[model samples]
Every structure is written in structure tokens, then in C-alpha cells.
Target: MPHPPKELYTIADASERWGVTTDIIEDYLRSGKLQASVHLPRKMMHKYTRQPTECSFSDEVDVFDVDSCDPYSYMPQQGVFNLCYEDVNWDEAGKATLEKGGLYLSRPDDEEKCYYGFDEDFVLSRDKVYVSISELTRFEGEYGTTPRTEQQDCPEKVVKVSQDANPELHPKEKESLLKIVIAIAIGFYEFDPAKKKSPIANKITNLVYDLGLSIDVDTVRKWLKEAAEIVPRKKHKITPELLSDFGIPPHAKDD
Candidate 1:
């Protein structure tokens, strides 16, 4: 339950904060859009070799518990190790280096013997990179470069139509309605008669009426059954004419 370093965020943390994929964060680091630091455990030092016996340097060190998921030893005391780095490209081989804009202090030339540590069991880690929060001002406290999906785009049109039809609906209810309307437009719904005040419940009452559609579960079942009959026979692309057979007006679809 130790707190993560206040100044740094792991790739997963940055991904969530920026509303982007981990790969995007890594890309930002490579392009120099953000600065980063690598957390090198004492065990991961001396590449492909077993854990070392003692600290290489004489500085005061910080103790981080070994991640349970990591294959290294589970003993928390054994996980204690020092961190170090140098500025280098991620792809740099033969010598340990950062991916793009930071230093990797895990290993150094054997002759130089620049490793530093404290007296403790060697706790090596996966060599995860942490990004400084200060370097993230571009999209701080907001969603960043996550591209919108077609599903999101589709709901926007539905939301506009619903808002025009019912101006009094709360914004949150309208957002919920968009989801319900899209589900119905695509011919899918989990009709629950018992749940009365669900997101789609009252909001959809007016919408169903506005659309001149029946909300009865049995009626919807009949429509789905009929639609199923037509779908298999066509066995091809669904066009406006085919949609009309399912009671959808041709103009309802976006061009």
C-alpha cells in the first residue's frame, strides 16, 4: 500500500490521465513531446546476470516493494533496490538506455562500475518507465488524443435529434437516451419491465412516441422476428429499402 512517487506517473497512469493508449504515451516520449524517467531495480542491473551481493554506490536509497506479478523474489525486503538512469534512445542496444528522452541507470560500463545502492536484498523490477507530471501540461486534467470512434459519432446525430424533439430532458438523461436510441436503431435491447426509473425508462417514453414507435416488449419481439425473416433471405448488404421493411424510414439513416 505504499504510495507511488508523487512527481512521477507510470505509463498506465499517464495513459488514463491523458485518455490515450499506452502506445501513444510511449510515442510521445519517443517524439520528445514529454520527458520520462526509468525506474531500474537493483536486480535488473547487470543484464542477463544473477542478482548482485551489495550496493555499488554509497548513496541513501529508496525501497520499493517488488511487484507481486513480477517473477523476481516475493520477499518485500528482498525487493529493496536503488534506481539510476542516463539519457538514451529506447532502441539503443548493447548498453541499457531509455526509449527516447531520458536516462537508464540500470547498467554501466564494467570498468566504470557506476552502480550505486544501499545494504538490502536485491529487488529487481520490470524496468517500467515513469513520466513526470510536470511534463504533461498539454492535456492535463482532460481527455487527450484518443480518436473518436464511429460508435461515438453515430450517437451524436441521435442526441441532436432527441434534443430537438424534447428540449426539457436533462443533459444526463439525453446522454442516456442516445445510448438507448442507438441500441434500438441497431435492433438490440434488453427489455426489463421491472426497472422503472432506469436511464432509458422515462427519457425513452417521449422518444418512442416522437418516433411513432411501440415500446411494448411483445411488439418489439414480433418486429425482431419479422426482421430476422427478411435478413437471411436478402443475404447481402442492407439498403434503405431493406431498412424500410423493418419499419425504419429511409431518411432516418445518415447519408
Candidate 2:
């Protein structure tokens, strides 16, 4: 049997279509470079019956049948639900949806076999998420590149820094600041020719603000692009594990 054309793609589907890892798609979503929507099947959205808190009759006349009151009569058609492990059985629903070639969200950090570690950061609700297939296709056309994991090591390029760019700072101070900025760009944003520099610039600007520094974003962006030109493309492959070797401690924060 043939299935209908898909109008939306799940994170997993987009990962497969783009030849990238799911982490990459998630990063794009987290960075606000992509959009998605939460969806639940109409069948699953049906309101569940609930217990009554009190009898409808007066306290002195509480001899009427409790079954007379409709459980959902006073309840809103839509409301919140507890999808926690102890409250709901999500594995059965997730499995059923997948078996039918349908996409469904799995429990986050579930101790059971269905755990996929999906979290509230991705979607507030336990419902599955979907991205417009056309929008994702357009994104891929603009930003798709060779997966970082499969990229071969390349020689570093050398770019001369303009000494007069920031004459107010000493050469030594500039060098030190550039090193810190480059380290953050490489370690956190995987700065490289294939990646966009705007997000990296914005992140560095925020960090500088947190540190009470006054550098403007345009300057930070200029410095990053210039410094990134000389960084070895291979260095973009550095993983979080290797960051410790560079003296970046685990879970280190400004506060």
C-alpha cells in the first residue's frame, strides 16, 4: 500500500532527509533558525472523565445519586494533562503510532524502553512536533553542507588581523580577547566556513554584556569572521570532550 504525500516532517524525518544528525536539527530549532508545531491526534485529544469533588445537591440534601452529574459537563474542552511516567502509559501510544508509519513524541527521559530524552526545551507538551516540509526543504537548499563528522581534515588558512582596527586596545589585550572569542566560537558554535556567523556574534555579545564589557555586536562579528578565517576547518570537529583539554572546565559559568 502507498501512503499520502507528507506535508510535514518530524525532527527524525528531517534528519534523515538532510543527511544530518538529529542533534543538528535540534540545534537549529533551539537557535530559533527553524520552526515547528505540536500536534496530537484528535482521537487522543478526547477529554477524559474525572471524579467529582462534591455532590451537586445541598449539604443537607446530599442523598441524590452521584451518577446524575456528567463528569465532563463543567470541565473545559481543552486543558492540561500530566504525562509523567507515573501518570500515563506513553510507550504503548508511541509504539502504535510508529508502527503505522506515523510520527509521535516519546516520553522524555523515560526509564522504560521508550525513553528518547526529548525534553520541554523542544516542546512544552507531550504531543508530537512537525515542521513544514516545504520550509525545511527551502532551509536545506540554503544551508545544507557536508556533515561535520564525515569532513576530512583541511589545512588552516592564515588571515592577517588589521592592527589599526581597534587602536584603543593594546596588542596583547586584543590578542587575549581574540583567543577567548575564538575558543568560544569554535567550542560552542562550531565556527567554520559552512556555518553562519550571526548566532556566534550574538552569543559573544551577550556574554560580553554579562561580563560588563561594552563591545558592540558589529565589532564582535567582524572579529569572529576575521579570526575564523585562519582557524583550521578540522578544529570545527572538536567535541565537548576535547574542550576540557583546552582548560574549559565542565559546567563552568560566569555566575
TM-score of each: 0.26, 0.27
Supply candidate 2's per-residue lDDT for 58. 45
The candidate maximizing lDDT is 2
Supply the TM-score for candidate 2.
0.27
Model 2: per-residue Cα lDDT over 1-255, one tens digit each: 998658767778777766778777767765656655444332222122223346665454422121325463222222111122222223434521222211223322335322111211222332344566655766756776543333332222111133344347777787777667667666666555447745777777888899988789999888987666555666555655545644565444222
Residue 167, model 1: lDDT of: 81
lDDT of each: 0.46, 0.50
Which residue pairs overlap in candidate 2's backbone? none
- Model 1, range 78-141, lDDT digits (tens) per residue? 2222234223333333233233212233232245233332233332232356766555654443
Q: Give the poorly placed runs of model 2, Cα more than 4 Å off.
A: 1-173, 188-193, 210-213, 240-245, 249-255
